[model samples]
Target: MLDVKAQSIANLRAQIKAIEEDSGAHGRSEARSSQCNGNASRAQRPHRRYGTAIDAQRNPASLPCGCSVLANSENDKQRFSQAKQTEEERDQANSAFAKIQRLLCIREHASALLYKRLLASGYEEHIASEAVQRAIDCGLVSDERYADVLVRSRLSQGKGLRGIAFELEQADIDPHNVPAYQEARFRDSGPDELARALSLLAAKPPKAKRVREAAYRKLVQKGYETDVAARAARIFAEQHDSVAIETR
Candidate 1:
């Protein structure tokens, strides 16, 4: 039995030696065949492609072609597909960013043009209304506080309700709020209003035979009623001379 075992071992060794010799010869033959076939051409080289055979072999599903430079397994295919999808998503995101950047480059000038056209054309009254709202939201303007300040300033400058209302209307302010602003901002014998009216009378005393006519026109332009202008003129005359007032 011992001799038999020794013989078997010797036979195995001889078989391995023969197999190694045959493998070496086969490798030489394969190299010769590759060279003769011009497989190493610059264009035919694996480097010419984007990914190596190893990468394809690792991700067979992503390869799209049945060529494997890498000894990768089926599991690698799923991973490669996921990675490719991620790359695509990133590229799309980059493209979107570029588009937004281009649009924003002209955003400021476009916004101004839109505002001018909207007001001038009077398409819907506040054509840039949406833009104004967005501006306010973005802190470019304030509607509430601005309304209060503007009304106050106009009233102080001797502008009557009619004049102020007209101006505010032109500015696309809501009419409903205009009345409220007028009521809140001015009252009977308002100091600001009285001062403004007094200034108008003082600027040029009605001198022409059209003196009264001129005063009336001025008062009307200032947004005062005929009655209010007459009353103010009478009161003003009593206090000073050469100052005439009338209303239309």
Candidate 2:
């Protein structure tokens, strides 16, 4: 009996040792499977990280906080610069207008002359042009009226029609209107050239020895037509000779 009991105890000890060995083998297999799964997940993690980095690079707006603020700041700066420029132009325009008013108060100016004056006074081109146009709209500048006055004044000063026309051109009068001004001065009950030539001779008779020739030359110089000057010189010579005979 003692031997049988000892043998049974030895068999039980062997069975326990075999079960422990099996458990250890199963545990090792499970650990290896978990390690493989972890390695695969780690490999996929790098790919996910790389894809996320690519997306961020492609779209800057996707950046968390600063990008949108910077864009808005740039837009604001541009708008402010534009506004400031507009304000400066407005002030310049106002200054130009005031200068125009003061000049008009002093004397009438042709639009072209006023524009040149404004530029000389340091106004911007566009601003000066606008101011001059405004003056025209207000009727503060009238080329027609100025031309009328200038024509009469020049004629009274012994300027010939051709010389007066040249002065008008220098004053920026339209060439097409020159004929109209001439007609108004000479044809509308105005002073005729022949009468003007006679009057000029009466005022300052020729003192040269060749009286007729000197008279004719003087009338021509005073802006009379050649035929008119010749007729006046002949008539004046005859009248002077008759007066001398009466004196003798």
Candidate 3:
């Protein structure tokens, strides 16, 4: 199979070589024909002196008005084509560089999110990949750095470990990085799970047993552990019972 594939590639290269040779031969033939036609047309026209003094002094015959104009027009056309090609190349280079520059300008630090933004902003996949890789190399877009900050952010927002883990997953951070994530994970030295649960439970309006149970379920749904949720529910229920007794 490899031999057959190699042969096919060789055949394709031979075909391409033939096509290029044909195109060059055709281009040369056209160029000669156009030159002959231009010369013949210049010969048929009556000459009038209109060249610059230097042009006339140096070589008036070669820089006749018709021939000079045609030659300048062709040169201009070639120059314009070359300039357009150069502009396209420059634009691509600028876009690629600008994407990296934009990432560096982000003051909030970096993540896989920056890479996604570059891709979404219409950068080519390869360019985006290269930019992101460069960012990683420069430590300007470290997942570890992002994970540390994100864990702190989520914890400050009162999210639990499971919720934070899910958020990292959503951000496309690797599961293997979970150790780094945990190293920077939120820890409450002053409060155990039950204490945190109790505090969370204390912030609600008085409600019936079923609704309280539902709120406990909500906490669990918010990604707290089931054991913590149950403990908090117990504390909430006990406090409610105490309040009812005191009111009576």
Angstrom error at residue 34, model 2: 36
Model 2 segments more than 4 A misplaced: 1-72, 178-180, 184-188, 197-248
TM-score against native, each model:
0.40, 0.50, 0.52
Cα lDDT tens digits for candidate 1, 1-248:
99999999999999999999999999999999988777657444556456456446544565554445432455665666888888965554444334333444553222333355545644333324554445545554544444566666766666666676665666566645755465744556545455566677776555555444556666678887666666666655654534333321
RMSD of 2: 15.6
Runs in model 1 with CA error above 4 Å?
Answer: 1-130, 175-180, 183-196, 203-207, 233-248
Query: Which is the leading candidate under lDDT?
Result: 2
What does the lDDT come to for candidate 2? Answer: 0.76
Candidate 3 C-alpha lDDT tens digits along 120-233: 888767666776776677666777767777776765555556767787887887644766445534444555556655666666433556746875786676667787777777
lDDT of 3: 0.67
**Candidate 3: lDDT of 30?**
100
Total clashing residue pairs per candidate?
5, 0, 0
lDDT of 3 at 122: 85
